[model samples]
Target: MKAERRTQWLRGVLDLCILGVLYDGEYYGYAISQRLEQAGLGHIKGGTLYPLLARLEEMSLVTSRWTVRQQGPGRKYYVLTEQGRRVFEEQASDWTMFAEHVATLIYRRGE
Candidate 1:
C-alpha cells in the first residue's frame, strides 16, 4: 500500500523532473536516465523514459534530433521546446505549493 502510493507520487512528478533536467540543456536518453539516477530519482529504464519522451514530443513540449557518433550508432537528443519551458515553470510552481502543503500536513504536531 505504501509502496504503491509512493509509486503513484513518483509517476506524477516524473515528467516535471524530466523537464527540469532538459531545461538545462539537451541530453540523450541514457544521459537523461543517468542524470535522474544521480539525482536520487533511482534508475529509470529506457522502457519508461523513452515513452515519456515520445509523449512530450507528441504534446509539442519537446523536440528531438539524431546525432551520429564516429564510435557508435547515432543518438537521439532531446531538448525542451519553448512551450515546454512555460509548462515547466507552471508545473514547478504547482509542485512547490503542493510539496509545502504535504510537508505541513506530515509534520504537524497534535494540539
Candidate 2:
C-alpha cells in the first residue's frame, strides 16, 4: 500500500522525534538529516531543520560546536543539553500516549 501523507501536526511531532535522535549522540546537519530520512521522515526539509536547530539552541535545548576534520571542512555538531534530555523524556512519554490514542482512533475508523 502507498504511504499516507503527513499533516502539519505530524511534522510538529517530528521535531520532537528529531530532538530525541540528537539526544542519543552529537550529529552534524547532514547526519541528522540522513538519520531522520532513515527513520522514514524523507519529507522533512532543510528549511525546517535549520530553523528547528536554531530554535533548540535558543531555547537551551541543544548546543552546537564547530569542528574541523582533516578529511573535510568544518561542521557544526549538535548535542542535547541537560535540559534537552529532560525535555526529551517528557516529550517521549507524551508522544507515546498520544500516538497510542491516535492509533486506536484510526483503527476504529478503519473498522
Candidate 3:
C-alpha cells in the first residue's frame, strides 16, 4: 500500500502501537521505527512517534534513559513504566475484544 494510505490507516492508533512495541522491550527512536517498518508498519514516522513518546512520558506511563553501546551510537531508550504495563494489559484486552467484533463484522458483512 501507499505510504499516505498506510499513514491514514495508522492515524489514531499510533500511541497504542508504540506502547505495544515498547512492551516487547526497551528501544531507542530509530530502532523502534525500524522495528515497526520491519513489521510492515512503514508508515509510522518520527513526526508521529516522538510526540507520542513525549506524551506517554508526561503521563508517567513510560520512562526513558540513555544507553551507550560500543557497536553503534549512544541512544535514548524507552521502556514501559509499571503503570504502563498495567495499562498495556488493559488496553490489550480491550483491543482483543474490539478486534474480534470488527473481524466478525467484516466476515459477515455480505450476509
TM-scores for every candidate against the unseen true structure: 0.93, 0.87, 0.85
Residues 1-111 of candidate 1 have per-residue lDDT tens digits of 375676677799999999999999999999999999899877788888999999999999999999999999999999999999999999999999999999998999794
lDDT per model vs. reference: 0.94, 0.85, 0.86
What stretches of model 2 exceed 4 Å from their correct place?
1-4, 7-9, 109-111
Off by over 4 Å in 3: 2-5, 69-73
- Indicate whether candidate 1 or candidate 3 has the larger TM-score: 1
lDDT of 3 by residue, 5-52 (tens): 777777766677788889999999988888888887774568878888
For model 1, the superposed segments whose C-alpha errors exceed 4 Å read 1-5
Distance from true location, Cα of 76 in model 2, Å: 0.3
- Which ten-residue region of model 2 has the weakest summed lDDT? 1-10
- Candidate 1 worst ten-residue window by lDDT: 1-10
Cα TM-score of candidate 3: 0.85
Pick the winner on lDDT between candidates 1 and 3: 1
Best by lDDT: 1
Candidate 2 overall lDDT versus native: 0.85
RMSD of each: 1.7, 2.4, 2.0
